[model samples]
Target: MIHKLKKRRGIPAGPLRVIGSRAQRPGPAVETLEIVLKCDSFGTVEAVTTLLGKIGGREVEIKVIHSGVGDVTKNDILMALTGSRLVAGFNVGLAPRLEQWTKEHGVEVRLYNIVYTLAEDLGALARSLIQTEPEERILGRAKVIATFKSSRGSIIAGCEVLDGVLAHGRNFRVVKAMGPVFTSRIESLQVEKRPVREVRAGQQAGLKVTGFVDVRVGDYIECFDPPVGRRSSAWSPRGAVLRFDENA
Candidate 1:
């Protein structure tokens, strides 16, 4: 998720009283003070919430205007700040359509090119975006996935690699009606555990995920790769990588 601070000019400053005295001291004229939390996935909401809480503890008044997945539309931006006495600025993904919309609306919206899977960079970006106060805290977004396999109760899963890479020996989630039912690791990966490095989109593979029982067919397995120490290397078996969707 991306957090941003927006300020505007030309609004009346509210009443303020000087400390330990009856005289009135002028508060900084705040024609506009709006904060926006933007993200491309629902999972980012938690991280954004935590960041806001930390900022608030330091006396920054921030309200979440909108939080959801998908591209940020002009309507979403307008709705988020509508009826407020102050104008708002925006920080969103670098999408051309969004940029055009911002230009038409005449609101200054900053675009950030966030590299996926890097937690430290994301945290730093969030901090830089907020100018009111500074805090030394590190926060990151978590990765999640769902696994599907046979009904034999073994770790052999015929799964689709969505969003991010699913590698051998990595921890994953077995989604059930009661939320995440179990946490397991990929014991082995194969076109069937024949020793593969990574799996990508559009290719079905058998994964021997460990630590879960009753892993029925069609059950989803979710996995998370923390945003630390993630390598930028390409997945091997170059030909296999090509088979996956470039957009995935």
Candidate 2:
């Protein structure tokens, strides 16, 4: 029986209506990132291909498959690099030397032990290529000096504004000698027992925190604003996508 060959690249074209007795080899999509699959078992390859095809839709093209670890060779990596494709493996681990070589040669490879995680990762990668996401930026820092127990069963941190201005009702993180311990918002702020909206650098203020209680006297406090949305545009980092090839 002759099966129709479908084009998965550029503008959609009608499937090639051909007539042949034997099955023809499937081709990777030219317009999308191609993926090569390596699995320990043939069944795993079939299952993963179906799952990825459903989740990735038309954004990803996974066509090459190696049924066993021994079937993987340098040729696979060369094909991947030449075609600008990614190689993914399931339970077919690569040797330490080969893994290092791939990294040094700038080959894109990832291993996954779970099926759903692979699909989710592929979907996320596809979305990231075209979607805008939010990223965080630090705004200010403070140092906790003294902790006072309030009558209302809450702990307040007497802090010295370190870097930027510390404002009331803003998000804050408590950093200990080891690392960050808690994150909360400032319930209130006061300077010398007088209520204030914000405290500038090198100033001392008292902070009432909500959603945390273990703030220590020597801990460092850091404040951060809400994450700002960043979209990938021609003028941004997303526009100049870098592709490295060590073999070049």
Candidate 3:
């Protein structure tokens, strides 16, 4: 014989209990999170990818969506953050319109005013995340990298390559202590008064910039390169910039 319990919603509702040798409850479903990395300059691609890979490995559900050099429009913002919890690595100064739109849409976005250099921006963003209070101020270095042309149209630069490789015809910045002073292109590269195709880490080289003039010694130089597949924990010598080479 079996006991018939009174049904409430097409089922018995009385203690509503189950009996078994071992009771098992379903585990919570894992969530799939996404992130979007938008970069305009090629120099930042590798460093940004390395940083994201590290973060992704630590967080099981998080994923990174990589975007290339281009304008970040309102549509891009909406699509990227539609179901994401965080947005980062966007240059607010270059996309003022998009920045305003993000603010209006109630999306949570972290704005990095510094541009072109991925490693520097990543370090800055990581530091900001640990702060107890959020500050509206945007922090960045003032040094700029510029390439100018001599009378013979040879590219000349009086700047320091802050990070990555500076190749011919690459885009760079001429910066002062306040912020970005100018945007220009590299016309030619010269090292030790000798013309060359590329400059590597710790090498002081001169460049011919397409735009602007009066390049100074103290100015910062930025370069663009392909994304790096791996990262090293080893610290480079102080004041030394990194140059990515597949063979090396």
Candidate 4:
């Protein structure tokens, strides 16, 4: 049996209700660049479309929202506005008058007579769109064995490196039996009363922490750092929000 649909585009637009634009496909590690392609003929359209498909690598994706065999028209530019704001013409050109209109609309239109040049331009465009995301890696871990006040009145947790190396100026998370307490960057790390940059596994060191002082014995400390050249001075709590379970 067939049933009537409930909503289209948004909650059926009958009640003067206002809704935001529809969400496009989600972005991923490989960014997507949408384009409206117009060529002189269907054969050229198919050939260029196939070439564009294999142009981008895993970093960026080139998607053709619409392809047709004709000169660039207002409709094609409109489609580009809703997509990547780009239009490519192969062996075709936009009407002379539409040039000004396209610029005012903030849409880009590229006309190419040579297929090789077109492919080269598109390939470079894809590379330009590649976005490099910050990468994170755990530097080391340790367990708090004691706590004491430093000469500067800052609280220092005496920790024993349990598995990995712990480095100063790296972000850290203090976790207890209950859950994670807080996170901050390690301001100071030392061994035998001397300041040190890092401590390897099986080594005992004093770690000075700012913005938090409640570290307790038996608490685990996780130290992490972003890739080199990436900003590491700021810290964000990766642990889930703390909630007490009455049943537990």
Candidate 5:
């Protein structure tokens, strides 16, 4: 659970006031956040609620203010203002002049485009309040062979896996002659025109990266496993070793 500040319109911003009073002490644990939710489509609302349920479990609470047709009404804003809670909207928008009203009332309003991002934001807040430690592990390394443009206009790198394995969805860092230059996740991977989950050592594959686009030949790409938080542990390989015959 996360704690959100409650603000009164006339009061000056100072120390946090718990449950609408300046004298009350904060709770030992942030019980739960009551969020006013609005979404443009019923499907999106359902998806967001499902994801939030999965992520927050029983630690969060949501009140759907508007779903499927309407924009956030003044009543919704008034509800949040009087209740001293947050308002989250997906694809739906706030009515004109509501932004200023929220500011005046000191209510927080968050807007999101993607459902995953919306859930991620709230989940991150909760995790932060709980304090989670994440560990990182390297997975593989590949040498860039060539660069090309995909039909969708994304830059693709033709690479040969030199060590371990390069898998789809793995985080990667691009290293040039000087030093490491860029870092991001692999968007797509293909082996000989066929999509593949992974490319093992000594195999060549095409890689589409998400953020860092300026990839060139001879650059090194290092793949790493997703960082795991202390609360959730998942199996990950340590390393793969290859030895060449000395006589050869």
Candidate 6:
């Protein structure tokens, strides 16, 4: 977006109104964003593309798949849907249906009036493409020493914590012969006959996990936390609205 430049070169100014509001975008994958660029003039197109090409900082990339010196066209929108699903412009406008199409099909339209703002926004979007997905982390591991039946005859795995404490209410994966059997959570943990919240490493305990009925003497219990949330971030949309006689 480069403001303070009034030379239109040979482009005509048309009836313009703000088009397309943003829709919910999914978490970007770890890849480059190939976008489409449309501008009011050839000069602006080259300048905007050059500005975006320098972004993404090696961790991600901004690749312009299509470039044209005209209003966004239907072909541009169709081209965007191939993968990048994005269209950007300078001094352009859009039609009503194009706005709906973007919201419906998850296409992004970015129209910039300032070149600096365009570079900054696309840079941030590129960085956001670096994946920070949710992940499960191991909390503890325990080795099953014996398999026993309770007074009511429900089988329980008597175990000694190999390392890390077996925590209550945390999810656990049952493993045996170096392979996973099933996943369940600690339903009960007991040292002797009294229920406890956790048992530490080097300690003997009887544990019951739901959905882990086929307990074996040599099976292992791996406790882990569920997948965590994404990293914190916030960004506001800049001059993204476009109004023109035609839409892509």
**Which candidate number has the best lDDT?**
4
- Report the Cα lDDT for residue 32, model 6: 73
CA RMSD for every model?
21.3, 15.2, 23.0, 15.7, 21.0, 10.5
User: Could you say which candidate leads in TM-score?
Assistant: 6
- Candidate 3, 122-198: lDDT as tens digits: 44333333313222221112233545557753346655554457676666665555755766656777777788777
* Tens-digit per-residue lDDT, 28-145, candidate 6: 4335777777788877877777777677654576777777766675556666775467787767766556676676666778877667777777777767667666788888899999
RMSD of 1: 21.3
Query: Candidate 2: where are CA atoms >4 Å away?
Result: 1-133, 228-230, 234-248
Task: Order the numbered candidates by TM-score, best leading.
Answer: 6, 4, 2, 5, 1, 3
Model 5 whole-model lDDT (C-alpha atoms): 0.63
Q: 113-188 in candidate 5: lDDT tens per residue?
A: 6666777766665444443357677799999999988655467899999999888877888998999888887778
User: What residue pairs are clashing in model 4?
Assistant: none
Looking at candidate 4, what is the lDDT of residue 193? 92
TM-score of model number 3: 0.30
Better of 1 and 4 by TM-score: 4
Tens-digit lDDT track for model 4 on 128-170? Answer: 6765556878888899999997655467899999988888788
Q: What are the TM-scores, per candidate, against the unseen true structure?
A: 0.33, 0.42, 0.30, 0.51, 0.37, 0.53
- What value does the lDDT take at residue 237 in candidate 4? 19
Q: Local distance difference test, per candidate?
A: 0.43, 0.62, 0.47, 0.72, 0.63, 0.70
Ranking by lDDT: 4, 6, 5, 2, 3, 1
Number of the candidate with higher lDDT, 3 or 4: 4
Question: Model 4, stretches more than 4 Å misplaced?
Answer: 1-33, 43-83, 90-135, 149-154, 210-213, 226-248
Which parts of model 3 have CA positions greater than 4 angstroms off? 1-149, 152-155, 225-248
lDDT of 5 at 200: 92
Superior candidate under TM-score, 3 versus 4: 4
140-183, model 1: which lDDT tens digit per residue?
11222334554566646677655456666666676656676876
